[model samples]
Target: MDLYFMGTNAGVPSLERNVTSLALRLLDERRSFWLFDCGEGTQHQILRSPLKLSKLENVFITHLHGDHLFGLPGLISSRAYQGGDTPLTIYGPQGLKRYITTVLELSESRINYKMDIVEHDGGTVFEDESFRVEAALLDHRIPSYGYRIIEKDQPGKLDTALLKKYGISPGPLYGKLKRGESVQAPNDKTVHAAEVLGKSKKGRIVTILGDTRPCPAALELAKDADVLVHESTFLHELAGIAHTYHHSTARQAAEAAKYAGVKELFLTHFSSRYKNNEQMDRIQQEAEAIFKDTTLAVEHVLYPVDR
Candidate 1:
């Protein structure tokens, strides 16, 4: 899986960055992509990137802020004409349903595709064979949320060499053996799958947070995540401003990443005050001082979740 950042600037768009929006590309796993947030001009950002609107299967909005979801109605309306005939599901806080339906109704837009809006307060968002996503309340100005995506463990690969030693060639028998089932050999002998199976690989965990102050729920949702995408809207010097605005500083974000034991921390939601690249680099340096594996979420960058 890969994270394609559409925009990273907080609040408003600037020459360097837009607002908060990203797409999690799961083309190899599901042949589709999921979007997080839909800030203004998000679709315009997608036009410049390798992401496709037709492959957008799910959208997870963290909050109801204008910077987080002002582009939703426009994007959804445009998705209808972009070969997106598949059903789409959107998950967000309580007021999302009203917001989406209201705008679409007033605009009188025609949607060729089916869409479902899930106004989730907390708890499990959805669970399937491949993944489980859950949400938790975050410390934002509004009732924001953070989502934890837990990928299911994959089965171990079958040992073809060991199976061949048992006088078994690739056939239906291979399927049974792959499932860890005992299979009968051609000579009327029984062979066990465990003797030849390799170790099962553990699943990857990704935590995406909305605008927030460092809180306990953030810690629990981020525990041991492979990737933790948290908002670092301010530097240490402006921490008081961050506190007043219910946002996190670069240092506080690093502390949370270190405490959560995440493999990597991507600091996003940069305030417009940090205009140039030099200022942005300072934010990363501040976080890296504590958690070495910190990255500033640059606009239009594709960050691989794992190598």
Candidate 2:
């Protein structure tokens, strides 16, 4: 899986960074992409990247903040004209359904495909054979949320060499073996999948958090995650301002990553105060001082979540 950063700025658009929007690209795993937020100019950002709006199957809204929400109606309406015929599902906070419905109604936008909107009060929102998604509230001015995406463990790969020895050529029988089933050969010989399959690999975890101050829910969502995408809106010296605004400093984000024992930390949603590269470097240094595996996540980059 990969994370495509569409926008990295916190509130408003910048010359270099747009507002807060990103996509979890599942091309390798599911051949689809799930969006995290729909900031302003989000569609334009997608046009500039390798992501296709047609492959966007899910949209997750963190809060009703303008930067995180204003682009939703536009993106949704545009999806229809852009060859998006597949059903789409949106998950968000309590007022999201009303907001989206109102905008689409006023605009008279007609969607060509089925769309499901789910408003949750912080808990498990989605689950399927491949993944489960849980949400928790955070310490933001608005009721922002953080999502924990858990990929289910898959069946181990079949041993090709062992199958060759058993006179089992690759065919429909291979599918049965992949599903961890025993199959009988034409000669009346049975072979067990457990004896030939390799060990199952552990599933990967990715946590994407919305705007917030240092909070327990943030750490809970990030616990042991392969990738923790957190917001770093200020420097350590301006932590009081961060708390007052219900935002997190770079150092605070790193501390949370360290306490949560996450494998990697990608800091985004930066304040526009850090304009130049030198100023941005300060934010990176502060986070790295606390957690060495921190990265200043940039816009339009694809970050991989490895198993």
Candidate 3:
């Protein structure tokens, strides 16, 4: 699992950064890729990365803010042009269906792939065999939400030495044993899979928050996450402005990560005022003062999440 930042700017696009779009790459896993918040010019950002628009299977919108969702119509239409025939599912708060439909209608765009929209009311929203996604209401100017993605734990590798010790040869029976099945041997003896398998490995947890102020819901959603991606729209000195705009400062984001027990914290959604890399470095330094694992997010940067 990996997270690729396609856009990191907060409200508007700047020469240094784009708007708020992120791609959760699940290569070598069950899913291919899931996108979060397709901001304006997001497809243009994807053109610079190694991502394929045809592989985008799922999208989660945080809010209806233009910076968060303006790129939806273009991306959906472009995917069809790129020969994306697979079904795409989008989850967001209420009114997303009408918004998307209006865009499609106004643009007169026709997609070859099937699109499914699911409007959620902020709790545990989606669950599959491989992963589960939960959402919570955030303290934003608009009706926003934060999402927590939990990958399911998988069984560990079998102890081949133990299997061989029990006179079990490498064949389909090994597959059965790895699957935790008890089978009868040639000598009428029962061999249990649990006796030869190693302990199960824990899955990774990724928490991503939309634009919001310091809120309990955000902290709860990010609890014990392996990776926490939070918006930091201002410097710590601009706490008053951050509070007024329903956004978080760099220090506030780090504090949330520390409280949530997250292993790593990525701060994005930067204001365009900070044009130089030095300013971003200073913000990251401030965040790191509060949380050691805190870092600033840059466009196209990918962070791997290992299970």
Candidate 4:
């Protein structure tokens, strides 16, 4: 899977970056994309990138802040205009449905597709054969949430060479062996699947956090994640200000990633105050001091999460 940063700035849009928005591209896995946040002017950002609004299957709003959700109506309308007939589901906190519907109604926007809203309290919000999404309440000013996306383990490939040794040619029998089912040989001998298949592939874990201060829930959700996407709205020196605003500093975000034992930590939701690369590097340096695998999110950049 890959994560594309559409907008990485916090609160407002700057010349260098827009507000909070990220697209988890799952074209190879699910043939669609899952959007994390739709900040204002997010649609415009997508236009400048390789992302497609029609490929978006779900939108997960982190909080009810205007900067985090103001572009929902516009995006939905544009998706309809682009001939996206497939249904879309949005998962978020309470009042999300009202917010989207109200804006659509007031603007007289007509959508040709179905839309479903899910307001989850906590725990597993969505589950299927391939993946499961769990939500946890974050320590933000509002009822913000963080999502832990767990991909189910995949079965290993069949050992063609081993099967050939058993006088089995590649065909329907290989499919059965790959499914861990015992198949009968041409001589009526029972062939066990385990002896002909490789080890199962481990699943990938990704945790995306909303605006929040360092808290236990964040750490719990981020544990053992392949990628931990946390907000770093301030530097280490301005940690007190970050606490006052209920946001995290680079150091605090790094602390969470280190405690959680994540493989990679991506710091996003940059405060607009850091305008130049020098200022941004300082924030990244703070996080790297604690967690060496830390990266600062840049707009239009795609970060891959591979197992």
Candidate 5:
């Protein structure tokens, strides 16, 4: 799995960064992509990347903030125009359904595909054989949320050499073996799948949070995650401002990553104050002081979520 940060700025668009939107590309795992936020100008940002809006399946909105959701109607409309026929699902707070419905109705936008809008009140929002997603209410000015995506453990590859040694030719039976099923050969020989399979591969965990103060829910959502994407909207000197705005400082984001014991931490939702690369480097350095693995999320950069 990979994470592509479409827009990384905190509130408004700056010369260097846009608002808040992230695409979680699951091509290798699910053959589709899941969006975190669709900030204003988000479609423009995606136009510059390798991502295809046609392959988008789900959008998770953190709150009803304009900066985080203004692009929804435009994207949904564009998806229909771009020949996106597959169904799409959106999960967010209570007002999400009304917001999306109102905009689509007012704009007279008719999407060809089915749109499922889930207004969540926390807990598990989605689950399938491959992944499970849970949401937690975060401490913010509005009813913002944090999501934890857990990928299911996959079965290891089947031992081809072992099958060959048993004089078994590869076929549909190999698939059953890989799934840890026992099969009987035509000669009445019972082949145990587990005996010819390698160890199972562990799944990856990723946590993405919306704008919020340092809260217990953030830590719980990020616990033991492979990568935690949290907002660092301000620097240490302006921590008071961050608190007053119900936002997080660079140090506060790192502290949450450290407490959760995440393998890597990506700090995003940068304040507009950090304009140039040098200024952005300062935010990374300050966060590194607390969690050494912290990294700043550069727009359009694809980060690998490895196990």
Candidate 6:
């Protein structure tokens, strides 16, 4: 799995950053890409990368803020033009259905694909065979939420050497054994699958937070995550402003990462005041001072999940 930052700016678009949009690419996994937010010009951002818009199966919106969801209507309309026929599911807070329905009604946009919109009340939002997504309320100016994505553990690989040692030749029987099934051999002997398989591999955990101040709910949602993607709208020097605006400072995000036991911290949703990347580097340095495994999120950068 990999995370691609399409936009990193907090409130509005700047020359350096767009808005708040992220794409969770799962090419090698069971599902396709799952988008966290759909900020303005999100389709244009995807065009710059190798991502296919049709493969976007799920979209999770943190809030109704323009920076987080302004690109949804346009992207949905554009998908029809791009010949997207697969079904797409969208999960978000209340009023999401009304918002999208109003947009579609006013614009007369006809989507060629099936659209499933789920209005959540802030808890465990979604769960499939591959992953579980949970949401928690945060201390934002608006009703924002933070999401935690926990991937399911994968089954262990089958030990071919052990199977061969048991006089089991490679064939459909090997497939059954790999699936944890007890099968009878040609000599009418029972072979157990657990004895020949390796230990199961642990799954990866990724937590993505929306705009919010330092809150206990956010920390709880991001506990022990492999990567914690938190918004840092201000520098440590402007922490007072961050608190007033219901946003987090770089140092605050780092502290949250440390408290949550996150392995890596990705600071994003930068304020528009900083035009150059140097300010981001400085913010990263300040965060790294608190938590060593911290970095500033950049647009179009893909971060791989080290599972």
- For candidate 1, give the lDDT: 0.92
Q: For residue 25, what is the lDDT in candidate 2?
A: 95
Where model 1 places Cα greater than 4 Å from the true spot, the runs are 161-179, 183-188
Positional deviation of residue 7's Cα in model 4 after best superposition, in angstroms: 1.0
lDDT of 5 by residue, 22-141 (tens): 999999998899999999999888889888888999999999899999999999999977768999999999999999999999989888999999999999999998999999999999
lDDT of 5: 0.92
| Candidate 5 accuracy as TM-score | 0.96
Which runs in model 6 stand beyond 4 Å of their true positions?
Answer: 164-181
Give per-residue CA lDDT, model 6, range 137-223, as digits (tens). Answer: 999888999999999897788888877777889899978876789888777778888887788789999999999999999999999
| Sliding window of 10 residues with minimal summed lDDT for model 4 | 157-166
- C-alpha TM-scores of all predictions: 0.94, 0.95, 0.94, 0.95, 0.96, 0.95
Clashes in each model (backbone N, CA, C under 3 Å)? 0, 0, 0, 0, 0, 0
lDDT of 3 by residue, 20-105 (tens): 99999987785479999999899998889988888998999999999999999999999987768899999999999999999899
**At residue 73, what lDDT does model 4 achieve?**
86
Question: What does candidate 6 score on TM?
Answer: 0.95
Which of the predicted structures, 1 or 2, would earn the higher lDDT when compared with the native?
Answer: 2
Residue pairs whose backbone atoms clash in candidate 4: none
Model 6 CA lDDT for position 96:
95
lDDT of 1 by residue, 19-53 (tens): 99988899988999999999999988988989888
Q: Write the per-residue lDDT of candidate 2 for residues 260-282, one digit (tens) a residue.
A: 99999999999987899999999
lDDT of each: 0.92, 0.93, 0.91, 0.92, 0.92, 0.90
- Model 4 lDDT tens row, 17-128: 8999999999889999999999999898888988888888999998999889998889999997776889999999999988888888999999888899998787898899
lDDT of 2: 0.93
Candidate 3 — what's its lDDT? 0.91
Pairs that clash in candidate 3: none
